[model samples]
Structures are given as C-alpha cells and as structure tokens.
Target: MEKNSQAVFPNHQHSRGKAWRWTLWSVLLAAAVLIGVLQILVARAGPILKGRVVETLKTRFDSKVELDRLQVSILQGLNVTGGGLRIYPPDDVMAAGAKAPLISVDAFEFHAGLLGLVFKPMHVGAVHVRGLAIHIPPRKMRQQGAAKPRHLGKVKIEVDEIVCDDSQLVIGTDKPDKDPKLFELKHIVLRDVGPNAPWPYDAVLTNAVPKGDIHAAGSFGPWNTESPGDSSVMGDYRFDHADLNTIKGIGGILHSTGHFEGQLDRIAVQGTADVPDFSLDTANHPMYLKTEFSAVVDGTSGDTYLQPVQARLGESDFTCSGAVVNVKGKGHIIDLDVDVPAARIQDFLQLSVKTEPAVMSGVITTKTKLHIRPGPESVTQKLSLKGGFVLKRIHFTNPEVEDKVDMLSLRAEGNPKDAKPGAPDVHSLMTGQFEMSGGKLNFSNLNYTLPGASVALAGVYSLDGQQFEFTGKVRTQAKLSQMVASKWKSLLLKPVDPFFHKDGAGAVIPVKISGTKSAPKFGLNLGGKKPDQASR
Candidate 1:
C-alpha cells in the first residue's frame, strides 16, 4: 500500500506541473494576439474613422459632402497627419458651382495627447503644417420662415489675400463680384506651428505703409475668453524714418523703440521709448529725448479709464490727466482733464499762424479736453468738449523787461465740475456737479512787466466747452488804452500789421462758437454787431 501511494503521488505531481506550464504559455500567447489585433485595428481603421467624422459633421449640419484625401496616423496615440481634405457646399446650389468656393487644407498634423503613465494631466505635442490654402465660400442664409435650417440660407464664398507682407491673411467673400475687403487680417506669419496661436506677434508683421518700415511684436494671454485684455505683453515697435506730423510738427528721421509689460483687465503698463533727436517743426526745433512711461490704467470703470496718464518727454517730466482726448481719422485734440505742470508752452503757440513769433514761457496747468469722434452719434456728441483752462503765470515775449511779456507762464487746473468721484472701480479723485453748463478759465493775478498790471481771465464756455464768451478786459492803474499804447507798439515792430497792434491794446473782444461739440464754430469780432456776430 505504501509503494502504490508514493507512485501515485509522483504521477499526480508531474501531471499538475505540466498543466500549470501549459496554462502560463496559453495566457502569454493570448496577450500577444490581443496587441497584434489592436495594431491592425489602428492601421486599417484610419480611413473609416475619418469618413465617419466627416459624415457626423454633415449629418449634424444636414449637408452632403465627400472627402478626397483621408489619412490619419498616431505617434504615440494622437492624430498626426490627415490629407486630401475638402469641403462641398450644400447640394441645392450644386448647379451654381461657380459661386460656391471649395475649402481645402493640404497637410494637417495635430499633436498632444494624455500621457497616461503614472500621473500627468496635460499632454504636450507640436503640429507641423505644410503649404495650406483654402478658398472657403460664404454661407448662404435662408430668409425667415424658410422650411430648412440656417445653413440653407447661406451664400457662396470667395477668398483672396488683401494685404500681405509681414502678415499672411486669407479673406472670405460671398460672391466673386463682391469686394475682397469683406474680411481681413492685418498681418500674420507662421513660425512654429503651435497649439497656442496668435503667439509671437513679432514672427508676423513686416511693414506699415503711411507710417514706415514697421516692426511689431506683442504678448496676449487668454484670461477671460470674452475680453482678451492684455494680461502681459513685451514687444519692440519701430517705425523707421517716418514723416513728421502736420499738426504735431514732430518730424524728422524718426525712430522709436519701446517695451510694455503689464496686465490688461486691471491695466498696468511700463515701458521706455527712445526718440533720439525727434525734430519738431517748432523751435527749440529738433529735440531728442528718451521717455520712460509707466501707468496703471483702469479699463473697467469710466473714471478709472479717465485717470491720469504720464509721459516724460526728454528731460521734461509731466503728468497729463482729466478729460478724454477722443480722436477721429487724422484730427485729434488734447481735450480732457489734461494738465502740464512744467511744459514748454512756446512749443504749442508757435504752431499757429502768427505774424511775429510769440515766445511764451510758463508751467501749463489746464483742465481741458478735445474731441474728434466720428460715429453714429451727432457731430455735437461725436466731438463734444466741455472743460475750462486755467493759466497761472502767462509771460509774454519781451527782450527789454527782466522777463519778456510774451514769455508767459500759464498755470491751470480744472476738473469735470459735475462728475462725482466714482466708486473703487473708478479713478475719479473728486466728483460733483460739473458746470456742464461749460467750464471756466480763471487767469488769476497775471503780473506784467512795468505797470504791474495783473491779467485776469474769467470766462464761461459753450455747452460743448468749445466757446468762451465772457467779460474779459484789461484792468490796470493805467487806462486800457494807455497800457496797450506803451508796451505793445514797440513790441509790434514793422513786420506785423498796424491795426492788430499788440496783445494789451486789442479791443474788448467778445467770443462766440457753435458747431458739433467736437467741432464748434468760434468767432471773436467786435467790429460790427456785438451780439449778432457771435453765438456758441
């Protein structure tokens, strides 16, 4: 019995061992077969899969379309390339093939997929695109009450490159006869195909015609998709050898280099600009200065948006705040709550058509605003300007006196009278009932050379703030006639007119202005009718 039991045990053990080995081999073979099956499915299923995607799109939109080049491949496990791509317009317009432009993407490669190893969220991948051009026709939109969906109402499409240099753009149109300007991209250049687009603005643009050899680069981050405000941007913008501005008179071999970095939603910016020897039509004619500019701009609030903006022109440091300088096309004004603590006043006055050069000097402090708005609003609303200017020390030009009368100093400061200081969102320091009735320019204690006559100007302006009709007359120990006759005549000289004479001798000039708020008509004539000739 013992011998028989031992033999049976040995035999049983051998059989169990053989069974275990066979089971292990079978499991390994199955796994290998499964992997092979998956590989085949991936290889053969690409065309079918792409077709299904196209079919899905067509079905969802209720349209009939076909694909030419249907190719899909995976590096690790992501779409890399797809070719023979084309789009067919609706079938109803099949007879009008001429009007319907076809769309095409040459070679499209996509990268980026889940790592799926231990733990990693975002996938990283880069796309490589070959020559791609698409002639996407316009959509035909059906009229109201139509039986079919919106796609039936769409129109044909036409595509063309409007402006191309630094930027390459493909514009779409409804009809071949339609204007090519329907859609446009200012400029675009493709450097590295990226999942993140509109990146590297510098890699794109090349020129600015009316401006000059233009080079631009900027950074834009997507924060809130709706308002893609500038979160942070650093770019060098250069306009080489541009023409001087007719109005600004800042002309010459112009060159500027600047960099800006800051947030946009809660706007903050800091940058430096170098305009070396940027010539001005006026004298100290040509001046070169490097400006370091920094500001916290509030875009959310009107008051905050209207806050002060500072610029250091050359060695001159000035703060400009108040009123908004609305611009239209070529015309613009420094209209707003704008002030200059220590600005060269001569630079401005000389730009006007004056018989003799009026050299004035003063620290300008004025509450003023300008307008050049061209829009649906009335001209008055478009170019509406209502604010007063305050001049502190207005020095007239004079070679004889210790300080020339013409070398005037003006100190001005005025706020929006009725504007109530806004909430924390706004940047209004003070707000209240503004005399939107207009503004007041108060020239207090104007001290002149000899007679010690102080010039005082107090005037009320038009609703748009363009016209200043006030009781402004010369007051001095000497008669108004005497003050003008003495100092002004010698100053007038021979090159100028006799009737116009000098500043002090002029008549009690009345003022009137009327027009759009932005472009009001101005008149100052005491020759005939005092009231009829003026109205603002």
Candidate 2:
C-alpha cells in the first residue's frame, strides 16, 4: 500500500503540475486573444468614431468639417491626435470649390473620457492645439433679419483647458480695398471654457502686433446660438511696455490699460489711453498724450461716436464730441465740433510757426465746425471751416512788427457798464470772424485797437504758401495826426496827402501790407490796386 501510495502521489503530483501549466498557458492564450480582439475593435472603431465626431462637429457648428488623419492611443487613456483639421463656412455661404476656410489647424491632441461617451455630459481633458489660423472678414452691413449664429447651438463642449501653441489671425476689409492687419499669438492658454462653465475665463497670450504679453480675464457667452446679437462679452486687459511701432501710424513705446464692457453687436467702450512718450508720423515732437473717452462704435458701419471726450496733448486741453464715420475708407467723414477755449499757441510753435521767445503771448479761442470730404485723389479739396477767433491781451514784440507799433499791447475794449464793480477788466487783443475756404483764410471783420492807432483789416491769406494779402486803414493818434497835417504840404507827403487828409478823427492812411510771413512790405495803395498785384 505504501509503494502504491508513493507512486500514485508522484503521478498525481505530476498530473496536477501539468494541469496547472496547461491552465496557465490557456489563460495566457485567452488574454492574448482578448488583446488582439481589442486591437481589432479599436482599429475598426477608430475610423467610424472619427467619422462620427467629424459629422457631429459639422452638425453642431453649422460648418463643413474635414480631418486628414485621426489617431488613437488606447494605452494612453484614449488619447486622440487629429491632424490637419479644417472648418469651412456653411454650404450656403461657400461656393463650390472655394478655398477660403474659417478655421484650420495643423495638429491637435486631447484625451477624451470614455465615461462621457455613455454619460449625460461630456467632459474633455486638456486639448493642445498647434498651428491654428483664423481669418476675420471686415464687417458688412447686413439687413435686420440677416444675423448669423456665433457658436454651436444644441451641442455643449466642455474643455478643462485649451492651449494654443502657434496661432495667426488676419483681419481684412472688402470695400475700398486696404491692406489687412495680421496678428500672431504664441503660447495662448485658456481655461474653463464651456457652455455651463462660468463666463469668466483666464487667458494668457503674447500678441506680436503691439508686441506685448497680454494677461486678461473676460466673460464671454454661453452663446445664444439662435441670436448671436443677444450675446454679450466684457474684458479687462492690460499690457505694459508695449512697442507701438508695430502698429500703423504710431511709433513709440507705451503702456496700455483699459476695460471694455459691452455687447458684441453694438459696441461701446469707456477707457483712457496714457502715453508717456508718444510720437506719430504726422507729428514733429514726441509728446505725452492722455485721453479719456466714452464712445459708441458701430460694428458693421465702422462709424464711431465720441461724446464727452476729454483729451490732453502736451499742455493743451481739448473736449471734442462728434463722430468719425467710415474711417480710412473712400467715404471717410470727420464731423467733429472742436472747442479750444484756451490753447497756448506757443506750445505748438514747432507744428506751425518758428518764433523767438515771447513773440506771441496769450491764449487763442477757436470754435469751429469741421466738414471734410475726399477730394481728387484724396487731396482734401473741400476742406472748409467756419469759426470765430478771439485773442485776449496779445502782446507783440517782433523786430519788424515793433517798428510800426513798438511794444504794443492791445485788446478789445469792454464796455464799462458790463463790468462788475471793482472787478478786473476783460480785454481781447483781436476779435474776428474767420473762415477757411478754397485753401485760404479770410478774416472779413477784424479789429485791432491800440493806444496810438486803431487798425481795421480785411484780407485773405493762403495757408499753404503763408502769403499775406491785406488792405487796411491805419488811423494815427491825435498828436501824430496834427504833426502829419502840418507836414502835409511837405515834399515827401505831397504824393499821398489825400490818403491821410480825408479821414475823420485822425490821419487815416490806406496801407497795403503784402509779403511772406517772415518779410512783409508796407506801402500806400494810392491807386487802389489789388493787394496781390501790388505785392509784386
């Protein structure tokens, strides 16, 4: 029995070991077959799933969608890699074989949760995009009922984070053809963007046009897909040490901080621009400009209404309220009502005239309505200005001008009855109704009264050439009039006695002053010749 038991034990142990090995091998084979079957299912389901995703995107975005390649990594938590993803405009908007696409991506990657496939709400993990391009067309005025949706209507896309590595944006205009504006963004990251998420999102991006790193927080839509105009967005942005030279017409280094809170359909903004060292192509000197303004901007028409706008350029202050319509277009119109109640002419000497110290003193008051239209080849042909000017207590100290009226200070005499008791007097050196027409400045009713003489001049001055043509009657003081009367019979005065003798209280002379701004010639217009002919 012992021998038989030992032999049976050995055989039983051997048979059991063999059975264990066989079971282990069979389990390995089953696992391998299951893995093969899973791979086959993944290979078969990838294209079908990718096609369904493409169709879902097309149906949700109301656009044509295309994908070049779709890859799945089953070992990596269902990671997805999409190459050459493109979205085009709607079929109704795009013609056959059109090349323009709304959005394009070279490559994109994301990890999708399998639970969301069968669950209620889909949640996608971080999505990283590379080489993205977006094109924005210039606003076209559509009729009232022609509004379009901005985002997907019925679909909800919840993304934990979206990172864009390289992106380019282009903005272009269709009418009155102009160069497009291009902006490049690098390393743009956005967080918590979805329909059910909070409207405020965190953004970090680097803009190439203004050359700054922009950090912003904004509240955008859970978009109303039915009515895009009903969506509203607002943002607060800040950029420090931005290079303004990259932008058109501006050249300088600046810091910009502003907030834009408004509807996207009809835009409005209230902000302030602070420029420490600001320079433009049209300006001579680099200045500090600070402006605070509230404006309503038309999204479609590109027209802006700036009301109660306050601006300060250097030492000058301005409050301009008006609209500039169709800016930089063929039908550009600027209708601004500008009021400069007190602006120092000396501050802008480099912009206009070159003068020595104290050549002109006192503030100038100008109220004008500007109506400018495009001329032949955009030369500003019909530039007209109707305004009045008042120069208060102006002092003149030029060598050539002082020769006629030495160290003269004059103002328009105010009526004593209109002055308050013991109050200081209000005096204006020159008061005139001035108009600009046909590239010439006309001062029809100008009065300049001094202690020794009073001059009334009416003339037209060419602004472009700085040429003056003026004819005025200069009345001398009482004492000088008596002396000139006594010498009227003299040889020097014999040729022009009638010019000084025919006037009332003083000796009046018909004088013609005609010259360039620097060198003026004064003479008697005895033959009443036109100032232009007599200047020769």
Index of the highest-lDDT prediction: 2
> lDDT of each model, Cα atoms only?
0.38, 0.61
Write candidate 1's Cα lDDT for 249-347 as tens digits. Answer: 345455555454554424444545455555433233455555455545332221123345555553455555543222323222334454556555554
After superposing candidate 1 on the true structure, give the runs of residues whose Cα lies further than 4 Å from its correct spot: 1-201, 206-256, 259-269, 274-291, 294-308, 312-316, 321-335, 351-356, 375-395, 398-451, 455-474, 478-536
Native-to-model Cα distance after best TM-score fit, residue 337 in candidate 2, in Å: 1.6
lDDT of 2 by residue, 334-411 (tens): 677878789765543423233234345567787888776643322223557788877766644445554444321111
Q: Count the backbone clashes (under 3 Å) in each candidate.
A: 61, 2
- Index of the highest-TM-score prediction: 2
Per-residue lDDT of 320 in model 1: 51
Q: RMSD, each candidate, Å?
A: 17.0, 7.3
